[model samples]
Target chain A: MSQPASNAKPIILTGDRPTGPLHLGHFVGSLRNRVSYQDDYNQFIMLADSQALTDNMDDTNKVHRNVVEVALDYMACGIDPAKSTILIQSQIPELAELTFYYLNLVTVARLERNPTVKQEIVLRGFERDIPAGFLTYPASQAADISAFKASIVPVGEDQIPMIEQTNEIVRKFNRLVGKEILVECKAVVPEVGRLPGIDGKAKMSKSLGNVINLGASADEIKAAVKMVYTDPLHLKVSDPGHLEGNVAFIYLDAFDTDKAGVQEMKDHYTRGGLGDSVVKKRLEAVLQDMLAPIRARREELAQDKGYIMQVLKEGTMRAREVAARTTDEVKAALGLSYF
Target chain B: MSQPASNAKPIILTGDRPTGPLHLGHFVGSLRNRVSYQDDYNQFIMLADSQALTDNMDDTNKVHRNVVEVALDYMACGIDPAKSTILIQSQIPELAELTFYYLNLVTVARLERNPTVKQEIVLRGFERDIPAGFLTYPASQAADISAFKASIVPVGEDQIPMIEQTNEIVRKFNRLVGKEILVECKAVVPEVGRLPGIDGKAKMSKSLGNVINLGASADEIKAAVKMVYTDPLHLKVSDPGHLEGNVAFIYLDAFDTDKAGVQEMKDHYTRGGLGDSVVKKRLEAVLQDMLAPIRARREELAQDKGYIMQVLKEGTMRAREVAARTTDEVKAALGLSYF
Candidate 1:
């Protein structure tokens, strides 16, 4: 069961739902990690348009348009298309086939018990009205991961249960079929954790209007920074301000290159005299520096929609090859290989 | 919206889970109608091997073996391969793809509310532990029907909800995607309804050990008839027996050639003096007469597994063409037709 880890390059599966453009939260969470991972791992970046439709079924135009937006985000963030397979989820029919097979291995009770799915259902106010696709997406996610035989899935802390569910399916499938055809994936939680909303909420989301998209222009970036939440009670510049739960400090901690300056600012604020405007100005400058190049690349990529579509088309073909190989193995295991 | 009744042949979709050989119950409920329907419509007979895994996930070998058993049953029952397509559901990848897409249109609450699925959950003792595949199967069935653009689906009374669910998805997809890519199917409920088990249970199922297989030999037919439930109070031949709810009379009503003789026998039994043994013997003979040719045909077909496989492979290819066209339309409607 143990392959020599030193010899084989481990596979990493990661993707985003193409419901909206990539945001600063995405950059801090998974996109940035994907950039460097291309050099070391067998990486497959999926534009999850199908999974996006799980909840956004009525907003398919958004999903369709965001496929390119997400691709542009990846290209702008230095994720070399040549080094990674950037596939569209719906384009790989094999994933849907595999998902159908994997769906059998999971129980409705288990899906209901999935913390991420459960939380999302409540968050979306779906309660009992959650779409079957939305509830069963963990199985689909498992299929997506196992189709490429991914050994590592970079996910958030909330998505750990999904990884557990994937491994359970892998084990159940292998045990029942008497063949270890699917690989179990480990959740590689990024060190940066979650970047909070500009409103100081725990999550940065488009629905909450707290997100600064990676593709934001200079004006949009400034406007978003101006709305950043800070010490509301600290009315006077000389008043001692709360450093904890402050969005400005948090953004600075995440994006600002000047660590010593950030600490000095924090110390002055805690002691007495750092103003919100001064701190906001510094945070805005840091964000502008980080986003300026990405925004420019996105604009350039937008001009060549044909190339992005080609990349996805070619990558989807490549992904289908891998997924088809896995599905064939699965079919053979289950004695469904009629051909 | 209404296509002419004369110009185009309406399509009918029907199938069975390949869990066991077809039984007399299946014959009375669906198979007999399917045979006659071949001339009136374009028919697709699917061996639902994939759908069978929703509950029988650990029994792949059973599913594999029964696929051939089901094909043999179809052939033995006079389902002409030339007039109707005999497809294995798993062989058509487009069905799974379509299922994934339609799954987005149905909510979990709707699945939970499906009467057939609800009853099945209780019947299978699944309760909260229902397999996700089982819960989501209505969507899969919708896919199976719509992939062929099937206008009519022949099902039992209990399956009316399934057809309704299929129509809902079809309407939802066509409405949301702004394209009439899918056709809603009408459920054609057969008049015979569910055949009772030999033990007098309302449903005759293979798992209940009460069914006579369509390919039962004369000896098997005799043995099955001997165990048929008769009136418990009719201990003596002269004792008055209940005509209704008697399994022997039910089987006679279903299979006996002489309707007048059967009616006379029923009257005699209700009026007393008709022995249970006498009725059982008559049933045994009638069943034997009906099953003999089917048994012979099945035995002959059983001798040619390669031919059966070839038939399925060819039928699957044909089925794929239809499913692929539908999926392509769905993709184009969803704006996923990148090519």
Candidate 2:
């Protein structure tokens, strides 16, 4: 049953908000790591639709439609439903309850001072109109992490403080209850994180219109490669190119399996005589080769939306059991366990 | 069946934070009204343990123990379980989910600006250490109200802002989803809302040692009556007594049903012929009469804790069904209706 029980391995929790379809930036930063993590760790990949709603409450249709698109992307990129549990956040309901309890442990001023939330508020230009849920999202995230007792969370360096906050709640809950009912999690910061956009922005955001969707067609990939940000100072084939901030080079660095070949091309381009077209062709070819199988698989999965939903339903069912056990324990700790 | 099913009447939502045994201040201000309201309204009385955790997170046992005590207070005061549903808020997990959703409709600044929340913050001396749950309790209250589609919320005047916040969430949720999914609730502000403390303070509070519990013994009632505040200038029976700010006179006005006798006593006291001891003795007798039956019922119910728990469990089961239906509708409206 259940492939000889994968619970022997340590648990890792990771996923993206289902506000939009994922992109190459997501793949290079987190999804690729998660696909590998499923083998070594008991992985739970969440489709954070509720967290998506904290910001996209006005356009719920966008969040609803993207759940399937994001699921397709996950399956296409080889996130095996048999090995990894892929669940929707809203479906559990226990997470919300856990979040409610955790909110009591965190001070409002401390939440406002969370660097990630503070930066996001400014980035979204929320000013004084910050939705109460958006401000309390870190508490919600703490629930997501501790509900599974996940020991490992794969996130970027910018999200280290979230792990700290989760542990703070974990410690506070246990100390207040005089029992260790919840576990603290550690952030696993990847060395190769964050792929720049085709426009060379620090973040590949959908609103910026610079991101290439993971399910992008071959033509779309080719077009994006053609417009990839290259060194403007390198006007002629004889001129030496600067590799820093070059989107094509960055994508090649992230996708190319032949490290020696990429290093040779970089040297040739830096020393002059490597035409931009040649590098663009190589980058386009590499991207097409990497994404062709994923694109075809995504197309095939898209045809059977019912199967994807079934997988999520089963996964959410499994996830709910785990979260419910934790919630019961939390309630018991809080002395709220009524028969 | 079940007394012709009280679900036919308009629903009323009301409750107390079960942080302590309910007291005389609770009875005169709201419990008496609720006992009468149960026949005319499909009442849902919530034991707000979760809300109690907002400020009393460090002492959750207080919330837990008081749930049964408070339930005893209600049952003793003739809140028929067959007419009014008695539920523990934490038992209905859907309320937490609904609260998470409703929080998105309110802004951090908007919740911070609520006059009731603002005043309470200062009174509690929370300053910069307000718990996130405390800051967002209005959203939780909105969930408690709208989950039952409650149109009437019996509350004091100070709590009107909470009802306003609830309606704002209901309107915003319906307008956002383009459907009338949740009903707006109205605050039924009681004219005789507050009962002064034994020390003649504006409010009776347990911490101030000025409240008489609904389950107080006859001797306890007499002792509390003996300490009731009176006019300091009335040194002798010949000295004129001021009835204003005199807690015993106020309590007589609140509990003594014989209005003509109370009026006669007031006139005699104003005419400088009645002694303070006479009023205190009269208050003691009135309190003993009012509390005797209730105290007996509370004592009998306390002997059978399991039965009280079973009642709450059954009521919570019924409450869960009502809340679940509304949660589904809310999810459907938000386009989060994933199977």
Candidate 3:
């Protein structure tokens, strides 16, 4: 439960906005990696409810209700709470305090120039009316990373800029204060990179209704697979199909365990032998096999909401202990430790 | 002391940054009002060491050392910790947490457009390199004001925009969250307004070296008065002098209790035959008489640094109770109070 040995494995920090239950995109992008990394590193999985409120401030009820949903998803996905700490962001006051201090090291111009922030502004259509929290969240994210002294941040390709921004603040603060109080973090990009939405969009998001939740039921999976974007030119079984931009085949590539079997299916579809329903049925079988266990685990975890909260509360206490040590170091470096 | 009665006077929130010992300008600007307001209203006096570090982040030892210096000045200037809470800014973690929440209510563009922040950026010559903390301090100020639920915030006229900005966030939060959880604050500008520096500049700033410390010794008082700006056109003490832009007369108008004597001096100086040295010596006498009791009190308080710190610790505990309650309400309104 304490920190690893003196020559411990490097630490990893990763989490999701508690806006909704995590989905297959999360599994392919970071969750599955977190499951694999639990034993190799000291992992801290955070339920970023505070960060979720930065944009969804009006929907606190959703954010509040989703903290447990997200935790359940993590547990069902094999993120063992005993091996990896599961924390609620708002419960740690030290992170907010550390964020306040980090803001001094960054500039509005720099925050505005952040690629992720800029893209989100355009995506959200908040051109001139961006929230201060939304705009400065890079600094807040930097706080989340550095407060834990997290050296490895598991993120997607698009989030490379955020990791760079975190390191910039770390360097700026250390240089200005003449103390290496904060550690720089590097992003560990997932090999799967991104999983397109069921509708063939670039990202699988809950808001778009294109996502298949990690704990989706068999019927729900079949319904989502039926709507999956496919080759419109393939009118009959004998017509040649285009595999490129086919959402069903793309998902099969990500989830199908048998690479040779997936290759044979792709070959048969391109050569006009496999029908869309036939390919979808194959994907349904693979997904149902993967999701059944998760659904069962999620159902069992859902029955004990108090236990889920207790896990988060206990993890928050442990997380706060580490964050407090870092905050004390930060204050000592800034000469703000009055006592 | 507890809050006032049913028809109680409005609460007032005012404070000074602990960057240095307060000077004559602080006395003329706000400290004097705080002393009298303690008897009529619920007043909360803060030693804003955290805000001081927004710009002076690298010089925290200076900030740390000055907290006690500023607190001692407050006590000597008649700000009773028993009647008016004298809390340190960094001690109340709730304020920082509240600031984080309030940041979401404000926008980056709106913060940049704040007139006070804009003017300060120009004045500080920080057009390109402005610190994020410096730009967002208005929000932090808003947190300071709202955390205490102060109905009245005593500030300079230039800070009117800051009050407007705070109220904007308050209204936005209440409207968006569909709850009236925050109180809007009114700026209580003093009639005396800004005090001119000894060199006749518009501000008596410690960095400008134009200030006479409130706890100045008699010798320091004479030295500062000797350098006070006066009418340059009155050669040989025989020429008529312009009353406008005379720093000495301005100080007398603010400090001299004998209005008739000050007017006679002004009339004599305007009509001619009154030497600058004579006027300076007379003003010196007035300032000395006023500062004697303050200097004695400051001397006594300076000897008991532990007592001053204990007072701050106790007052911080009291301030945290009020701030914590407000934070809880804010969270409940935002649906962030998970526990």
Q: What lDDT does each candidate get? A: 0.91, 0.92, 0.89
Off by over 4 Å in 3: A1-5, B1-9
DockQ scores for all predicted structures: 0.74, 0.83, 0.71
Instruction: In model 3, state the lDDT of residue A51.
Output: 91
Q: List, in the given order, the native-contact fraction of each candidate.
A: 0.82, 0.82, 0.68
DockQ of 2: 0.83
Candidate 2 residue lDDT tens string, A20-108: 88899889888888888888888999999999999999899999999889999999999999999999999999999999989999999
Ranking by TM-score: 2, 3, 1
**Number of the predicted model whose DockQ against the real structure is largest:** 2
> Which candidate leads the pack in lDDT?
2
Candidate 1 chain A lDDT trough over 10 residues, lowest sum: A1-10
| Displacement of the residue B43 alpha carbon in candidate 2, Å | 0.5
Against the true structure, candidate 3 reaches a TM-score of 0.96
lDDT of 3 by residue, B87-128 (tens): 888888888888888889888888889999999999888888
For candidate 3, write residues A53-83 as lDDT tens digits: 9889877899999988999999999999899
Off by over 4 Å in 2: A1-7, B1-7
